[model samples]
Target: MQRILDRLLDIFPAADRSFILLRESHSQKLIPVGVKQRHGEQDPNEELALSQSIIKEVFTNKRSILSVDAMDDDRFSQQASIINLSIRSMMCSPLLVGDELLGLIQVETNESEQQFMPEDLQVLTGLSSQVAIAVKNAQLNEEIEAETARRTSLQRYFSPKFVDMLMSGDVTTALSGKTYLGTILFADIIGFTAMSEAMAPADVLAKLNRYLTIIQKLIYENDGNVDKVNGDGIMAFWGVPHSDKSDEANAVYTALQMQRHLWSFNLDLQAENQPPIHMGIGLNTGDFVAGNIGSEDKIEFTLIGDHVNLASRIEHLSGRNQVLISEATWQPIKHLVSAVQLPPFMVKGKSTPITIYSIRGMESHEQNGYIMALPCHILDENGRHLGRGILTDSTPLSNGLCLRLSTHMEIERETVLTLQVETVEYHQPLVCVVKVNSALKGAHGGGSSYTKVVLTLMQEHNEDMIEFLRPGSCVATNYTWNDLKRR
Candidate 1:
C-alpha cells in the first residue's frame, strides 16, 4: 500500500503530499496506513480528518473528485483544517473492490497555480483499482499469518495431536464441555518477588523465561498439557483432551524432574554469582469440566472446577523446593514414589481438612531413615536446654542431613542449636550443631501443639552426623540427655 502511494506521489510532482486512508473495522475511523509528503511540508497523514473533507466526499460518492482552491470549495470550505492549511487544490479517488468502498487515496497541493486537472483525476481513478486489489491481498495475507501464529502459540499449551483434533473439527462436539478425570499440577518460582526486585528488568525477564522454558519442557516430556502460565507460576494437567492410565504417575514424574532440573539450573546461577532459584509444586486428581471457555470470538480450551482450585490452593501451601500432592493423586502413585504423610490441614473454601503428602523421591531401595517418635534434646547457643522434641524424620542429601523435629518450643529460622540424638543406633552420644531451616507450627488431632522444624547440620559436622545416622546403624534406645552428659 505504501509503495502504491509513493508511486502515485512520484508521478504527480506538483502534489505536496499523498496518503492512503483505510477505515478501521472495529472503530469505523479512517486511519492513514500509507503516507508520503514533500520535505518541509506538514505530514498529510497526521493532519487528515475524514469528516467534511475531500477524501470523505470521494468515499461517500464512490467516485473521483478534483477540487481547485480546496479551501474556497463549497465541499471543504467549512473545514477548519482545510482552511488553516490553505489547501488550494486536491484530487482523490475511492479504492473500491466490486461495489464496496475499502478506503481512499488522495494527493493535495498547497499552491493554487499547481491545481489538479481532470486528466490527473482520470489517471488516479485508473490506479485506484489496482491499489485496491493490492491492499486487499495484503490484508488477507496478514490475517493468514496472524492465524498461523495463534495456532503455533496454542501448541505451547496443548499437545500437537489435540491441536490437530481441534483444527480438524474432530473434537467440536467435545468442546461444549464435558467432565474428565485428570491430574492437575501447579508450580511457581519461590521468592520470585524478591528475585525480581533485586535484578534489572531485562535480567529478570531473561531468568524467568529460562525457568519457564525448563518447566515447559518437562511437562511436555511427561505428556502433560500446560494449561496456563500465571505470572511466575504454571498450571498444567494430564488426561484431557486425551487420557491414559498413567496420568497420575506422569504428573508426579514431571514434578520430580522439574525439581531435579531446577537444582542443576541453580548450579549455573551459582557459577554466575547469582542467587539460586527454588520452586514449589502441588498436584491433585479429580473430575473437572474441560472445554472451550469464553466468548465465541475469543474462546479458549481450559479446565474449571473445584479440583482446579484445590490444586492451586495446595500449591500455595507448598514450601520452597517441596512437592505436595492431594490424597487422590497420591493413591494412584503411592507405590511409585516415597512421600511423607502430612497432617490433615484446613484450606480455604473447604469444609473439611484435606490430607496432603510431601514427595521425597521416586521409589528406591536407598532409604533415608523414616519418621518415628524418637526422643532428642535441644540445647540453645549458651548450652542451655530449650526443650525436648521427637526426631520425626531424617534424610541425607548432597547439602546435608535433614532432620524433622517435633518440638513444643518455637525454633527460630537460622538459629544454631546442639541436638543430642537419644536413639539406639550409636553407642556414643551423637551431638551435632544444626542450623534451623524452617519451622512450621500446627496442632495434632488431639489438640497438642507442635512445631515441625527442619534442620541442616553445620558444614563441619555433616560427615560425622551422616555416618552416625547412616541407614541401618545400631544405636542405644531411650537414652536421655543426662545419660549423654555422663557418657
Candidate 2:
C-alpha cells in the first residue's frame, strides 16, 4: 500500500501532500494507510475526518473533484480545516468498485501559484480505479487469513470433525436452531474441590487434563461432539450436525468404557502413591436445540433446553465411580446393559421426583434378571421386625430375588419371611411371603456392611409387579408426577 501511494505521488509531482485513507470495516473510521508530505513528516496513524469537504465530496459522489482555490469554493468556504490550512488548491478522487466506496485519495497544493486542472483530475481518476482493485484484493486476502486463524483456534476446543463442519459452512445451515433427538452425557470428577485444595494448582491442572483427555478420547471414539468443558467436568453429545440410529446405545457404551478406563487410571495413580480419582457420569436422551448461539463477534455451537438441564441435574445426583442414566436413555439399550433402579429423588426446578438407575454392567445374554433398589420391610412369621432391606435385583422366572439388608440376623435357607414392598401404582403396599435362599456379603464397600440375601417368592408374584420390575418398563418421561397429579 505504501509503494502504491509513493508511485501515485511521483505521477502527480505538483501536489505538496499525498495520502491514502482507507475506511475500516468494523469501526467505519477512515485511517491513513499511507501518507507522504513533500517537505514534512506524516503520521501514518492519524485519522482523517469524513467531514472534510474535498474528501467527502469525492466519496459521496464517487467522482473526481478539482478545486483551483479550495478556500474560495462555496461548498468548503466555511470549513475550519480548509481555512486553518491557509487557502489550498486540491484534487481528490474516490477509490470505488462498482457501487461500493472503499476510500478516497487526496492531493493538496498550498501554493496558489500551482492550481489543479481538469486534466490533473482525469489522471487521478484513472489511477483511483486501479487502486480500488488493489485494495479489494488486499481486503480479501486479509479476510481469508483471519478465517484460517479462527479455524485453527477453534480446533483447540472442538474435534477435527466438528471444526471441519464449521469450516464447510454446513453447520450454519443444518444445525441453526434445529431440534435434534440426541443423547447428552455429563461427566464430573468426584470430590474435585477437596482434591484441588490439597494439591498445588499446577498439579491439579496436570491431573485434570489427564482425566479430561481420557474422557474426550472415548467420546470421540463413540462419535460424540464435546459441547463444553467446565473445569473438572465435560458435557458432550451425540447425533448433531448429523444423526445415527444407534446414538443411545453409543452413549451407554461410552459411559461403560469410561468407567473401565478409569479403573486402569486408578491403578496408575496407586502405583505413584497418589490418591485415586473417581468420576460420576450421567446420561439422558431427548430433543434439544443445537446450533451456534451468540452475537456477530462471538458464537458457540452447543445444545440447550430442558433436556440439557435435566441431564446436568442427573449428573449431580450420581455417586463416585457410578454411571447413572435417565429412563429416556435406558429404554432403547435396556437389554444390552444391566442397571439397578434407584429410588425416585426430587430434582431442582422440577415439581416432582425423577427415577434414575445405577448401571451395573452390560448384560451378555437374554436374562430375566432385574436390578433395583427399593425400600422394603421384612418380618418373621410372627409379625416381628426381622429386618429392613433394599431389593437390588429380582428374577421371578428363576423364582429368586436379591436384597441388600441392614441386619446381620441369623437367617438360613428355607427360613420363611413376610416382605412388604412399596409401589407407585397403588396406595397399599404389596405383601408377599418368601423363603431365604442364601446369604452373602455385600459387593459394594463403604458405610455399614450390608448382608445380600437371595430369596424365592413363596406366593404367586403379581404379573403387574413383575412387569414393572422389568428393564424398560418403569422408566420416567419428561412429564413429572406433578403433571400426572394435575391431570
Candidate 3:
C-alpha cells in the first residue's frame, strides 16, 4: 500500500502538496518544508491552490472528490486564477495511514473541459498515504544521524558523564587557548636503575603499569590530563587543557591525591615483602609550546618546550616517596597542599642553588591556588604591546589548555605572544624553560614589565631579546583539549 502511494504521488500533476502529521485528533499540523510547481505560467499554480482547497474541505465530510470539470465551475470562478491558465478538471483523495487521517492529496489539469473520474481520486489517496509514511521515516532517520554525530564527538575525548554535561550545553571547557600564566607539575620515579634491577623483567613491567594506572586515574580525577609520560617521568602542566582561574587548585589536588595514593601503595608493598618507592616531582609556572605534532596520518597531542625539560630535571633530583618541587610550583600549589621548605641545593652545571619544597599533604577542603594580583604583560612579534588586561589570574592545567594574557597589548591579532611569566623549572644559567598557557594577542607594556620579559640568559637578562615564541605554544591548539576534557 505504501509503495502504491509513492508511485501515485510521483505522477500527481499538482506542483505542491501538504503532508500532514497527525499528532493528536485535535492538534493536526502540517509541516511545511517545501513545495513543487508545474513548469508553466504562474497562473496555473494559483488555480492549483484553489483546487487543493476544495479537496481538503471535503476530507472531514468523508466524501471522495473527482470532479474533472474544473475551470467553468462556479465554486472556482471567483478564484483569480480562473482566467489565467484556464485550468479545468481536478481530483482529490483522503490520505491515510491505517485509521489515522494523514492528509489530503489533489491532482489538477489545465484543460478546462475534461472531468476527473472517481478512480483518479482513489489512486491519489493511495499514493498520498505512502508519501506520508516515507516522509515520517525520513525525518526519523535524520534525527538519528544527528544524534550519532553528537555521541561520536563526546566519546572521542570525554567520559560519558562529562559528555552528557556537554550535550546539555555546558561550555566551560571551550575556553580557547591563547597566552596566559599558571603552574606546571612534573613527576618521575626515583632511581630506575636500582628499582628495575631489584625485580624480574616481567615483574618490573607489571609493577610499572600498575603504578601508571593509579597515577593516570588520580590525575584524571582531579581534571588534569597526564600530559606526556616518558619512562618513569611525567610532565603534567597545570592551568591548561581544561581551565579556569582554579586550575592551580586542581593541580594541587592531583598532587595531593598522588601523594596519598603513593603512600597507600608503599604500605601495600611493605606487606607484600616488596621495596617501597621514591619519586621526584617538580612544579613550575611558565609558558611552553603545547599542541599537536606530525602529519595528519599520525599525530601526537602533547606539550613540548624548554619548560617541559626543566620539569624532568626537577623530577630527576627528587627522592624516594618524596615530591621535589620548585619554588614556582610552590607559588600556586602551596595553599592547596602542605609544603615544607627543603634546604636549597645546587643542580649540576649551575652556580645558583634552587630552593625546593617537600609536598607532604592533601587538601580536604577545596580552595584556589593562585591569584591574578601579579603584574602581567602580553607581548608579540612586533615587540611589547598592551593586551587585554594584567592577565590578573589563571587556572592550573591538566587538559593541556594554556593560560591566556589579558587583552592589553598592542600586538596584531595575527601576532604570536612571547610571554615573560615566571617558571618553576630547574633554572639553569644557560637552559631555562617555561610551560606555555596561552597564545599571543595585541597590546603594549614597557619599562619594568618589558624588562621582566626574559629575552634570553647571559648571567643577566638580555636587554635585546633573541628568544621568540611561536603559535604552537598554545596548549589548546596542539592537544585538542576538547577531547581530553571529555575523557
Candidate 4:
C-alpha cells in the first residue's frame, strides 16, 4: 500500500497533494473527505470529506470518475463541495476490490492552469486498482483479527468461514425446496447427557464449541455446510449451497476423516486434563427440502425431510467414533468404499429396515465394484454423460421394474431391473443392471428427454421377486400417466 501510494505522488509529477480516503463498512463521517487540520498543516487529510460520496458513486456506477479540474466540472464547483482550497486540477480514481467499491482517491493541486497529465491519471488508475485490493484485504484482515478476538473471547463458538459467509449474506442456496442429492451427516458426542449433568452449563458449552471447531474445519475442507448445532449433536450437508455429485461420498469420507482428526484433538484435550470426547456420525443421501426455515425472528439455512431424520437415527445407533451410512448413500458409492454391514434395524416411526454400513478402508472398496451407468445417458472418463445405453450386459433381467439409482450420470433408460427390494411395483431400490435397455429409441419417441421414466416392479419382500412384474403397480422416474394427461 505504501509502495503504491508513494508511486501516486512520486512516480508522476506532483499535483498540490494527495491522500487516501479510507471509509470502512461503517463510520463514513469520522474522516470525511476534504480537509483535516493536523499539526498546523491545512487539509492534511482532505481526502476524508468526500469519501462517503465517492464510495457511494463508485458502487453505483462500478467505475472511476476523473475530475481534471473540479472548478470547471459543475458537479463540484459549489463552495460547499470544496473540502479544501483547491483552485484547479484534480483526478479521482475509484478504489475497487473485486466487485466492491472501497472508496475513492482524489489528487488535487492549487496550481492554476496546471493540467493533470494522462500519465498522472494512468499512474493513479493502475495504483488505485492495487490500492482497492489492498484496502479490501486490510479490511478483511482487520475483520479476521477482530472476529478472532471475539471468538477467542467467546471460546471459539463458530468457524471463521461460517461467521464470514453469514455476515456476507450468501445463504440463498441453503434455503429449502431446491432439490439436490448429497450426503447428509450427523455427529453426536456419546454420553453427552451424562457429561452435561456433571459439568456446569457454561463449561459444557465452552467444551462443546471447542470440539465443534475441529469438526467444522474438517467439514469445510470437504465442501460441506454445518447445517446447525443442536446441543450435543451436529447436522451438516455437502453439495448444496454448492453442488457436487460426490456429495454423499464426501460426507461419508468426512465422517471417516473426522474420526482420525479427533484422535489428535482429543489427545490435546486429554493433556489438558479435559474429558476425552468420542463421536458417532451417520450419512444418508436423497431428495431433501433445503431453505431458510423457521420463524420471523430466526431463520435456519439447512436441510429437512425424512432423509435428514433417517441420518440422525443412524448416527444414534452408530457406535462411538463410527461413521455409519444408509443404503441409499451406499448404492452409488458402494464401488468407492468398503463398508462393513451392520445388522438391519427398523428406524423409528418406519416399519422397514434400513441397512447400514461402516467404512473400513478405501483401497478394497474401489476394487470390487460395478460400472456406474445412469438411466438414459452414458458417462465418459471425464464423468460427463455422453452417449446413452453404455451399461449393456448379456444378463438383462427385465421384469418390468426399473431401479432408480442416481448415478454420476443422468440417463432415462428402461434397463433390466430386479425388484428384490421394492418401493413401488416398478420402483427398485438397488437394481442389478444387465444392459442399457430402452423402450423408445427413435425420433418418433413420445417422451422428451424430460419425460417421466416408467419402472415396473419385479419383486416384493413378502413374495417372489418376479411377482412384482405381474402388473398393477407402476414405478416411474419422471411422472405418472395421470400427470401426463393433465400436461
Number of colliding residue pairs in each model: 5, 0, 78, 30
TM match of model 3 to true structure: 0.44
Q: lDDT of candidate 3 vs native? A: 0.50
Error of 2 at 442 (Å): 37
Task: Please provide, for model 2 over 105-208, each residue's C-alpha lDDT reduced to its tens digit, 9 standing for 90 to 100.
Answer: 88887887888888988988899999999999999999999988988887666667777887887678332588889999999988899999999999999988
TM-score of each: 0.47, 0.54, 0.44, 0.46
Candidate 1 all-Cα RMSD? 15.2
Instruction: Choose the strongest candidate by TM-score.
Output: 2
Give per-residue CA lDDT, model 4, range 66-127, as digits (tens): 66666776766665545456546767777777776677676766667667877777877887
Model 1 lowest lDDT segment of ten: 442-451
Local accuracy of candidate 3 as per-residue lDDT tens digits, 327-429 = 7666655545444455566666556887766554333344332222112244444554444222222223221112333223332322344444321121311
In what order do the candidates fall by TM-score, top score first?
A: 2, 1, 4, 3
Ranking by lDDT: 2, 1, 4, 3
The runs of at least 3 residues in candidate 3 whose Cα sits more than 4 Å from the true structure, single-residue gaps closed, are 1-180, 198-200, 241-243, 267-274, 333-336, 345-353, 366-487
RMSD of each: 15.2, 13.6, 21.7, 17.6
Candidate 4 stretches greater than 4 Å from native: 1-32, 35-177, 200-203, 263-275, 294-299, 349-351, 364-487
